[model samples]
Target: MHRFTRILTRVVAPVGAVALAAAFTTASFSPAAADTAPAASGPAQNYLVLYKSGGSAAGASLAAIAQARGAVVQNYAQIGVAVVSSGASGFAARLQAADPSVDSAAATASFGVSLAGDAATDAADPVSPPTPAPGSDNLSGLQWDMNQIHAPEARSISGGSSSVVVGDIDTGLDFTHPDLAPNVDFSRSVSCLGGVPDQTPSAWMDDNGHGTHTAGTIAAAKNGIGIVGVAPNVKLAGIKAGDAAGFFFPEAVVCAFMWASTHGIQVTNNSYFADPWLFNCKNDPAQRAIWESERRAIRFAQQQGTTVVAALGNFADDLAHPTQDLQSPDNTTPVARDVTNACAVVPTEIPGVIGVTADGNKQFKSFYSNYGVGAANVMAPGGDSVLQRTAAAVNGRVLSTWPASRIGSCLRKVFDSGATYCYIQGTSMASPHVAGVAALVVSSGVTSPGAVAAQIMGTADPIACPDTAMYAFFPSVDNGAPQVCQGGTAYNSFSGNGQVNALRAIGG
Candidate 1:
């Protein structure tokens, strides 16, 4: 399994304002220290206490009493807290004794714990392999490559289009977008909040444009207005969990996952990061519950044979040096001397999810992509230049859908004035490329996320990245490193498995 390095921070707060408390006393802690506290003797016992909303008073009172009894409060959320006691015996009684307001408590012998292990010692320099010529435009043809190997290989393999449903668990989609309307699977696409049905047929409406572009990359209908998606035939189910500000809460994401699992969604694309300010969920009960819920949902998805694809975050730090970057993008002011890595790659790191990194033009890894050996299962074209246009001057760059809310915002002007299209760059963009391909693969009958990931990684063209001083820490061999940044042999960390060769991936 691959693991990205993360920075961990501790925020101790007063009982009255749990949210405000976290905002004030934020401090950095080492990953090991942040993740693990001394476990008590006997079996590791964990329990979740579900309290009524706004019942923090009751929850905190219970936590105080649990601390007195040498049981650590593992996490605290708005709804409840997850407590790990020293002894399994009589925990419910003790919890109830601590606070009678506890509505219900469920005990478990062990809770799933994710520990940052040692870095990969045997990781070698990248290797060079044969690569397709650039003009092949392998990255542009979304579903073609995936279908070549997994789905029925044909020019028009849209036969199972309606049967394959993809749920996008990202910023909301622009369901009304013209390019995406015809194929939008509105039946399954719905928002978790308010239990409202998706009114927009496209469900590709993005408040931040991130989700819309991602959705377009995955399964935008081939209406000839925008670029075709990898799984152009598949139906898309949009689940709007992220807020308008482009923020995704763990609870919301977990809820999206659970909803997707129950609603016949075969795959989901999660393109958000964890709170950059926090790391381990040990002290945060709400985060822990969300994490647990996400895992459970992922397990359920697997049982239902759904694939979950997630992006490795843009935090530019290594697993060994997870605390280096701590500056906020908006504020030059340093938030903390060091912070734990909370890249979006978490649930992906969990077994059964597909973790993706970004590369473009078959040569360089996206500068913002997070890279650790075994960390990312595959790579895809995320786009380098903001213009994302194949012909540069023609068509005024990429014609993908834009987030509905941001369509007229100042940021949207960068792409086109008064147009519901925007040009942005990040691994966030790259993830959907692989996701689109996965949908195509699923359409081709490859049902498992792991199997799709294996096919994508196994079939990619290997290239060596150029030895830019900025990427010095990235492993590169003499044979693989390209003389230029964009020109290299295949299979460097810079461009994992080379550019996602659709023709090769689909067995052309």
Candidate 2:
């Protein structure tokens, strides 16, 4: 029913897109073993100095930083923040005191945490399902996630348009993987880690497997080999933002958005909760820079025609009505603090971004997924290992492409046709299902972020809250906190507008 037909496979030429990479080194730390340092006194530490809005660009703050014995590394002039490296112990306060144009300066690591430490790869998903149908990929039977969202049925009508490029802004991707090679947009792909763009494929290759898995779910080729993606014919650009260890610095995230917007990336699948504090509090002066800088970058990307789809989180808390934050300041000594609605998870909770929660094949919200009334905008099959297990979903996990070289610790891994694959779960896996749907929508000529979002929500299938008693079994998942559901059946927190329907997304 859409205008454009499916596109043929072609390699997008490499385009040149940094290590401002040495600034936030976990090895270069103060003896405290904490991510924060009182003085820039040890090895140089990286800090993001936020300039007041409508003021001078990051360059204007450079002089003040240098006067405080710090040197400006990368300047995100668009967002008015400067990445500064200094060996002086008290550089941030001194820089702010020396410059009236500066709002606040905070250590980059103080606000960036690795989501789910294993790069979104979780254990407890070891069981493998029986072989798929004879003609399909040998492992297709394990793809209950594709079947749940009706992606294959949708693909019969549309596999997305190649012109609409979707960027997976996570760990670097494995472009050599057969499933991803055909649709890989080599030209638009770049690594923004360390706060700069490096277009070299080796620079952005998948040192960590998270990016490859997400990329596979979004746009793996329908090449009759590995599993086919939700939007198999669309282009996939791997924009590496998270490091191999999985730390996502705020500056790196900002650089990624700037790159995506400037390069015309239509959709970016961000399965991360940027910043070290799980819940960044606005009133807190220490966190304002991290909160505002990242928010503005996302807003700018949206303004420039990039639709961002993010995972709600794995915290299992009600994001809409937040109370206490048990896990925060993740890189340093974690102090359990009382939180209110004033605090929120980065990127996902940020305005205008599409927030997705995860559910298994049984249609129950994953016990590890974060949810709240009106918090998430949509839901997808992220897989739940405990409650949703079935014959097909042996361990109730989503299966996708994995790197052949990396000897990852994923409980179960599949070697198919000489390539490696694995089973994993998280809102991380759930987000791409919707991102792929968003790509399908974008392929239909709904290019604007707002219109693309509207199309995705309009086509989703709504679901009501499940029995509250179900939460009892998974109480141990999130520190024994009680999971509650709010809103009507048509629009609840757990399932959001509803599970995404790929066929409906493309008007099949």
Candidate 3:
């Protein structure tokens, strides 16, 4: 399984302690180098450049772009987004200087994928129902999260549509995994590494297991061999935006959403936040540029009729009233800084995107889930080891399909068929459940993304906060501060709307 130790959400810091965000960025990409260095060993460092709305795509022609000491690697004409590569100093500045119509320009940020803590070893812990569920596949008994969302009952009403494609835009997918192979829409899958799209299926393969696990939860087959997905009958598209190392760069994110919009993707599941800042504070010029470019790509996807579902993140912070953020510029050195409404986590806080938080079998917020009154749109089972632990399910983590080739400390391999599975916990594991539900809703006759989102909210069950006074006493995943919930049964921060009801979502 893929495990990332340094993400904004995964850092288990002492209270008031500062920590690094996932895959800290290199401070600079200066052109200075020794002559003894070999030829460029990797893809050209790319930048995400977005043109102002209504700007002419041709205005960014090759001749004009060359003036910036950069060349276009890929041009998304419809969205006015371009991925450019340059070794020149002040690459972004040079590009903007050459084109005043460009709305924003920032170096594409990189990220290393985060791994859920010790989930693989926990899978080996003794589980109840020693065998599989009577009518389910091999690992169904371990999937309490599915039952929590009523996936079994929902699937009975609608298992999702063959034409409704749900794209998993993360580390990529393992097309060969038996459980996932049957549902993967290979023709729609592509690798958007370095912001350049490669149509070859192998290029989109899951070098890291995170994408495969999320894929399983969204659309793993119901072939009586492995665990079933929330919407077992829908087509799953793998948009390989995160690289082999688990980093999700800005260029890849822009490409992924644009790809989904152009293709027939009805929905997309986003688990990781875009780099290099953990929170893109609009007050900062560079950070504002990052958010603006990524926002344009996301907004364009929604405009194209794709419903976006994203994780609220594993950082147990109150997103709406953020006070201090010690983990900015995760791709580089992080500094302690205060933030306000001007700062926002991309995709999660972005309007129109369905933001999801995590809960456990106990129905409480996962210690690591980020929440705020207006931030999270819904909640799903993300698992909790501290609160939901039981003798059978010691870790209380989410179990899903795993990549067979990837070797990591937190992996649970199946020896019989060389196929594999693993356990992980995070909003990363939670968002796909909602995305699957959204796919089912779309398949069940709700035709538009707006309509699908409305159905998801309208069908959710309302939940009230648990002992507000005791919030300060509850243990948190980050071991920093206890979490608190606000609002009533109708809406709240901890469990938005309510835990996603797959059965209700599918008209059950």
Where is model 1 poorest over a 10-residue stretch in terms of lDDT?
1-10
lDDT tens readout by residue for model 3, 62-175? 555676666777777676777777665566655565677877677765421211111011011111111111246777778898888988877766777677788999889999
| Cand. 2 TM to true fold | 0.85
Candidate 3 stretches with Cα past 4 Å from truth are 1-11, 16-44, 56-61, 109-135, 411-417, 468-482
Clash counts per candidate, in order, are 34, 11, 11
Candidate 2: stretches off by over 4 Å: 1-40, 57-60, 110-136, 476-479
The predictions' CA RMSDs to the true structure, in order, are 13.3, 11.3, 8.5
| lDDT, candidate 1, 214-317, per-residue tens | 78767766554444566666678788766555545443444465567666777788776543222333234433444454455466666666787777655433
Question: For model 2, what is the error of residue 412's alpha carbon versus the real structure, in angstroms, after optimal superposition?
Answer: 1.1
Q: Please give, for residues 385-425, the per-residue lDDT of candidate 2 as tens digits.
A: 87889988998888888887674645578877777787888
Winning model by TM-score? 3
Pairwise lDDT winner, candidates 1 and 2: 2
TM, every model? 0.62, 0.85, 0.86
Residue 418 of model 1, lDDT score:
33
Candidates 1 and 3 compared by TM-score, better number: 3
